[model samples]
Target: MSAAALVVVKCGGNPAVDADAICADVADLVRAGRSVLLVHGGSGAIADLADRLGVPHRTLVAPDGVTSRYTDPATMEVVTLALAGGVKPRLVAGLSRLGVPAVGLTGLDGGMLRARRKSAVRAVVNGRTTLVRDNLSGRLGRVRTALPQTLLCRGFVPVVSPPAIDEHDQPVNVDADRVAAALAAALGASQLVLLTGASGVLADPADEGSLLRTYEVPATGAPGRFAGGGMALKLVAAREALTGGVGSVRIADGRVSEPVRRALNGAGTVVRLSDMIPSLKGA
Candidate 1:
C-alpha cells in the first residue's frame, strides 16, 4: 500500500471514546479502498478488571502531566487480560460484523512493537516527585511495519495494542498513542488520526468550547501549548510522526459518527510542520 492510501489511527481508552464508532469508521475507510491500521488502548477496562481481581490499580502522573497506568507486576497481568481478552475481541468482532477483515495483534506478536523497559520512572506521587524503581513500563523503540503492511495489502485491517515485548522478552505496558505514531512513521503513512473523548486539544481542558482547531508542533521537539493529560503524550506522538515525514496529523473526537471521514475532512485539530512555534518544554 502506498503511503498516501495508508492511515494510522489510535483509539483512546477513555470510556467516552466509543470503540463501536471507531470500528465502524475504520470499516468505512477500508471499504473506501484506504489502508487502515487501528491501534487501541483499554485503560478503563484495565481498571475495572483490576478491581475485580483485587489488584491495586494506580495511575501515575509524570512530571510532564502525562498520565499512565502504574503497572506493577499484578497490574501488568490485568492490563494484558483487559487489552487482549476484553477490549480487542469486541473491536475485532465489530469490524467483522461490518465485513472488514480485521486481524487483532499485540506488540508481543511477531515483535511488531519493541521497546526498552524503563527500570525506573520519575513521577509525582503524594504531591512529591519520586523515582519509582520497579516500574514495568516501556518506551517505544522499533515498530515492525512489514507485518501490518502485508495484512493491509491482503485487504485486512491490522488492529494493534500493548503490552509490547521488551528486550528481555517480557511484556511491558506502552502508551497506545505513541505506538500508533511509531507505526505511522515506520509505514510512511500519509495521515495519522488520533480519536479521543474531547473534540480536540482545548485551550482550557475544563472548557469544552475552547477547542484549538489547529496546533503547530515546535520545530525543536519541545512542548507547545495544550500539553496536558493524555493530550501531552499525544502531542509528543504527533511530533514523532510529523518529524518522521507523515503528511498530516489530526486529533479529533471519537464520539461522533463517521469520525475517520470527519477527521480527514478537517473537523479537528490539524497539525502541520509549517505551523511550528517556539515554546519552553513543559514539565
Candidate 2:
C-alpha cells in the first residue's frame, strides 16, 4: 500500500492566486501521490465586492486592541459567493483539466469547519468601550475529520475554506489559516503550506536578506498573534497547526509557478519548532 500523506494548502485570496496555476499544481502533486487539501481565502474579492455593493467591510479591534477585518453576516455572504461560487469551481475545473478529481466544500457542508459565533466582540464606541454583538466572525474550533478522511481514502482531494460551523450550527467567519490548522490536525498532515503574494515570511518585508527560510514559530498567547498585520495571524495559525501534530507548516509565494511543488521541495520559509527545523543551508 502506498503511504498517504496529507498536506493542507491555503491559497491566499490575494490578487496573486491564479486559479489555473493553483489547480494545475495541485493536480501535479496528486499525480505524484500526495493527498492535498486546499483551503483558500478571498479577501481581495471580498474587498472588491464590498466596494461594488457599497457595504463597508469593517476591521475590528480586538480586546487587546489589535486591528483586523471582522466579517459580519454580510461579509460572510460575500465569502460564500467568492469561495464557493467563484474560487472553488475555478480550482475544481483547473484540477479537472489536469485529470485530477477534486471535491469543493464549505464549512456549512457536513460540518466541515466548525466554530462558535463570536458576535459579542469588543469594539470602541465613539472613544468609549462597547461590546459589539451579532458579529459574524467565529473562532475555528473543530473540523469534521470524516469528510476529508473519506475523500482522501478514496484518492480524491478536498478543496475547502472558512465560515466554519459552530456548536450552535451558525455559519461563522474564520481565518483561512485557522481552518487549515484544524484540517491539518484532523488529517494528520505533516505539512501545511500557506501560499501568499509576498515572499514567504520575511523578517523585513522590504529587504531580501530578511527572508526566513527555516524559523521557529515564536511562542504566542492567542490564535492570531505575531509581530505585524496578517503575518501575526498567520504565525498564530502556524503555531496551532504545529502544536496539533502537523510536522511542519510552510509559507511561500503563491504567484510563483508550481507553488505546491516548490514549497514541498524547499522553496519557501518553513515555520516549525526549533527541534523540527532542518539545516536548510544547501536547500
Candidate 3:
C-alpha cells in the first residue's frame, strides 16, 4: 500500500543518520504530496559532547543481560539541550531552506506530547544486571493531534523533538522509537518508518540471512528474537502502534538514498501488522 495521510519518521542521531540526506528525502516526500512529521534523536552527539566535557556517561545491566542507557538528571539536561538546542532547529532550518515552511517545537508546545515519568529501567553492563535508578525517562500520554493536523492542513512540516514535561510538570526524556510509535498511532499513520543504523531486525544476530524481510509477528512470541535490550523495547513499541490501529511499522537502514520514500514502497523490513498472526504461522 502507498504511504498514508501522515508519514511519521524517526531519524537516529547516529553519524550515519545523515541529516542532510534525511532532509532531502523528506523534501522529496513532501513534493510527492505527502504530509510528514519528522522526529529525531540526538543521543549520539549528546554522548560525544558529554564525554568531551568529562561528564559521566552511564549504562546499566539488566537481569536479562542487555545494556541500556539510563537517563539521570544530568543526562536529561543534556538530552534537552541536544534535542531543543540542536536537532530540532537544525532540521527545521534545513527544511525551510528547502522551501518546506517547517516549524520546530518541543512536544510540550501546545501539549503535543504529554508524557508520564518512567521511574524504572533495566539493563546489563559489564556482565552484571542492574536496576537503573533515578530514571527521568517519559512515556507518551495525550498527543495534541490538532497541532500536527493544523500544521499539515496549513502546509507546514511539523518537526518534533524529545518530548517536554508532563501535565504534572515533570520533564522526562523519551525514546525516539516510542515517540515515532505514538506519533503513528495519533495520526493514524499508514506507514511509520524508523530509520536506524542496522539493515533491519535480524532473525539471527550472526547470519546475514537472519534479516527478516517481512515481520508478521505473533501478538506473543518466544522472546529471544527481540529480547534483552532496546530491541525488546522497540518491538514492544511497534506492537503498541500496530495493535492500536496504525497500519504498519518498518525499521530500516537510514543511510541510503531516499530512505523514507523507499520504505513506503516495501523497500525495507516491512512489519505487516494489519493482518493476523495465524495467517502467516505456517508460511
Candidate 4:
C-alpha cells in the first residue's frame, strides 16, 4: 500500500462470497498503515430474516432490466434488523480476530450517509411500465467523512453499511456498491475495490476465464458490453467513483486469500478513464 493511499473496499453480501478473506485482507492493510473503510450489505441475510418473520421479499424490475429490492415499510424494517443485527457483527468479529480494531457502523449512525428518498419508482411489470409507490429506496447524497476519518485517526477500521438516513430522517435502503463509490469519492480515495463472487467482469457470465482485464469506462453512462444483472449497477458505481476522481476502480473475487492485495495489484477488471477502449486481456 502506498503511504498516502486511502481505499474503500466493498464486500459483497452474497452468501457464496467469503467475507472473512476480505476482512483478513483489510486487517493486513490496516496493519501496514493504510486507511481503509469497508462497506457491505446484507440482502441475502435480509431475505432469510424476512422469510422467518413472514415478510414477503419482492424485487422490482426496471425498464432497463435492472432488478432492485422492493423496500416497503415492512421490508425496510427487516433490512434494518438483519443488516445491523446479523451481518455487521460477524464482520466486526472476523476483523477483530485478525487483529484489526473494527468498528461497525450503519449509515443511520451519526448521519454518516445522508440520502434523498425516492417517493416512487417506475418498474416494468408484465412488460409494461408501472409505478410502485411508497418505495423506501434512496439515492445517496452527502457522506459525513468525519466519522470514518475520526475512526481512522483512532486506529480503527470502519466497517460501514447501508440504510442511509434520508432528508426526512427515515432509513432507506441504498446500494452498497454505490455507497462505497460515494464514500470513496468523499474521501478522495486512491482506489475503490469492489469484491464479488466472480473473478472479474466476464465477457460471458458463465465463463470465468473470459475476464475483461481492463475496461475504459466513461465518466458517465454504462458501456454496452458490460451491462447485466448486478454487474450493471457495479458499472454505474465505477463511473461515479472514477468521475469523482478516484484513481482507479476494480472488481475482483472475494473468495481468495489476500483478495484486497490481488485487486490492488490488478487481478481483476480494472476500470479507468484514460483507457480509450475496453481490453479483454487475461489477468
Whose TM-score is higher: candidate 3's or candidate 4's?
Answer: 4
Measured by lDDT, the strongest candidate is: 1
lDDT (10s digit) by residue, model 2, range 1-283: 1223778889988887665677788887888788888888888987888788777888766554445576776877887787888778878877788898889898889887778777587866567777877677788776778888888879888888867887778777888877888888877888898888767776666764666776665455533222356766777788888888988888888888788888888887888754333233322
Q: How accurate is candidate 1 locally (lDDT)?
A: 0.86
Go through the candidates in order and give the clash count of each. Answer: 2, 3, 8, 0
Of 2 and 4, the candidate ranking higher by lDDT? 4
TM-score of candidate 2 relative to the true fold: 0.88
Once fitted onto the true fold, the runs of candidate 3 whose alpha carbons sit more than 4 angstroms away are 1-3, 61-68, 124-130, 205-209, 218-229, 273-283
Q: Can you tell me which runs of candidate 2 are displaced by over 4 Å? A: 1-4, 61-67, 122-131, 222-226, 274-283
For each candidate in the order shown, give its overall lDDT on alpha carbons: 0.86, 0.76, 0.73, 0.85
Looking at model 2, which ten-residue stretch has the lowest summed lDDT?
274-283
Clashing pairs in 2: 115-165, 115-166, 119-135
Give the poorly placed runs of model 4, Cα more than 4 Å off.
Answer: 1-3, 274-283
Tell how far residue 174 is off in model 3, in angstroms: 0.9
**Which is superior by TM-score, 1 or 3?**
1
Please give the distance, in angstroms, between residue 215's alpha carbon in candidate 2 and its true position after superposition.
2.7
- Candidate 1 similarity to native, TM-score: 0.94
Question: How well is each residue in 1-283 modelled by candidate 4, as lDDT tens digits?
Answer: 2324788999998887788888888988888888898999877899899999999998887775556889989999999898888999999999989888989999999999999998789888988999998899998999998888888778888889888999999899998999999989988888999998888788888988778887766554444455567877787788889888898899999878889999999798887663344455453
lDDT of 3 by residue, 56-93 (tens): 88766556433446777887777777788877888999
Report the error of model 2 at residue 266, Å: 1.5
Q: What are the TM-scores, per candidate, against the unseen true structure?
A: 0.94, 0.88, 0.86, 0.93
